[model samples]
Target: MASQGDRARDALLDAAEELFARNGIDAVSNRRIVEHAGAANHSAVAYHFGGRDGLLRALVERHHEEMSRRRRELMEQLGESPNIHELVTARLRPLIELLDSLPKPSWRAQFMSQISAVPSAVAVAKEVIGDANLPDDLRFINGAVDGIPESVLRGRAYLLGSMVVGVCADQEAKMNEDANKGNWEQVGRFLIDAAAGMIGAPVTDPDGAVRYPNVPLI
Candidate 1:
């Protein structure tokens, strides 16, 4: 059983997520969240979440929880051992699905872009989603890099992560540029294929590097 206050708080969080995802954290005001939540108390944001920063943390936590749930389910479906490509696909599928599930894609796109642009938000994101948070289905992907030296793995992982972020950011930018002209479903599919290809490509030594399969620039 939940109290009325609890219900109000939950409503506030829901409204905040909707606004924050669409408009970016800084763009949305506490008053707007309270109004959107249908709360009469003007201090609802502070009462429920301490303040704006607290609200932002709550939003980030909500995303983290949703991601963790999807990751767990995907891992459970994969069984004991899966290959690198499977691991990469499993890791990416939840993210694609999460974005697709949002009611307003434009809002989500703007929200994600804003988060990426903020250095502090980036640090928070990295802390919340470090290597330990990698799903079990994708463990083999990490294992695949075991043959590569630690330094090389670190470098490659950084590069690959940046590539994936860039792909997502570009998709968001394209969506913003021509809302009616682009389809996320199609772009998401292409991204998954492209990411899988990159994950499957062989790693090279740090020294200048050998010729490897070129990751197609999109």
Candidate 2:
């Protein structure tokens, strides 16, 4: 038995996710969200979420929760102690899949692009990452980082994360330009290969020492 306020809040959230995903978060107005939610009170968003920033935070938190749930499900499907590649793929795929399945991919792209450009979005992203309690996933990633030095591992992780974010942002731009045409599978494959190659095995001996792969150093 949900209260009227609770129901209104949920409706607002539902409307906000779609609206924010389609339009940039800054572009979508509180009035529009309330209108979209079919709430009789025009101030429903304010009443429910306090204000626009509060609404955005709620949306981000909900997305984090959903991502966590999807990651857990993927890990369960993979069974115990999956390889680094499997772990990374499992964590990354769901987000791409979500964007692909959105009713208006262009809107998602717009939203993501705005998020990429904003400093506050970075803060929100860091909060989500730090607050995420995925021990199994963390263990798998840390194990992958084992052979590499902490500095290199941190740099590599940042690079890999940035690459994924860049690719997603690029995809969104492409989707906006040509809504009817795009090869998500091809993009996914390219990212998988690119990320793997960047973070792939260190060229080394039995002892924990760095070694270059036997090829023309890039």
Candidate 3:
């Protein structure tokens, strides 16, 4: 059985996620979150999470545990050799699956999108990332590509992550009891295809030159 304190902490996180998702993170106050959680003590969040940043970190960590498990399973299936598509799918499938499982009016995707856009939220994520064991979804994809600088690859990955978060937020916004499940499936497939191209695309030379096989030189 969960301790009363643990349950109170979880309630705060759930409340915070919904509030942060519906309203921008900046717009939601700590008092609002505490109230929404139904905790008799406004200090429950402070007692459990220390503060807003701590609360945010806890929420992100909760989702990371869910997503990381799925990521590792996909990585195992991909084995020693996997295509870019497979790798991209592994990176994204967890979030998509999570969205599918959440109840209607769920706010997780939008909350994540907010996190991606906020420096504080991103900093919280960075802290967690530093401590956590992230699935190296880019390893095989990195091996396949040639001539692209490591910095460039990192930039592309950042862009790809932003796109995925933003798109899913949009998907969740549009979702309701009347919404078609096919739309969500199509969005997931589209994101996978686009991400594969993005992560695998050849980099151009610094001196205004193109080296990718198909593109004509400028």
Backbone clashes, each candidate: 1, 1, 0
Residue 64 in model 3: shift from native, Å? Answer: 0.5
lDDT of 1 by residue, 58-114 (tens): 666666677778876877788676766666666666767766675544444444555
Query: Which candidate's lDDT is highest?
Result: 3
lDDT string for model 2 (58-112, tens) is 7666556676788788878985666667767776776776667665543443444
Residue 82 displacement (Å), model 3? 1.1
If ranked by lDDT, best first, what sequence of candidates would result?
3, 2, 1
RMSD of each: 6.1, 7.5, 6.4
Segments of candidate 2 deviating more than 4 angstroms: 1-42, 79-81, 116-119, 131-139, 201-218
Clashing pairs in 1: 22-107
Highest TM-score scorer: 3
lDDT of 3 by residue, 26-81 (tens): 89989999999998887877889888899888978877777878988988888676
Backbone clashes, candidate 2: 1
Q: What ranking emerges by TM-score with the best candidate at the front?
A: 3, 1, 2
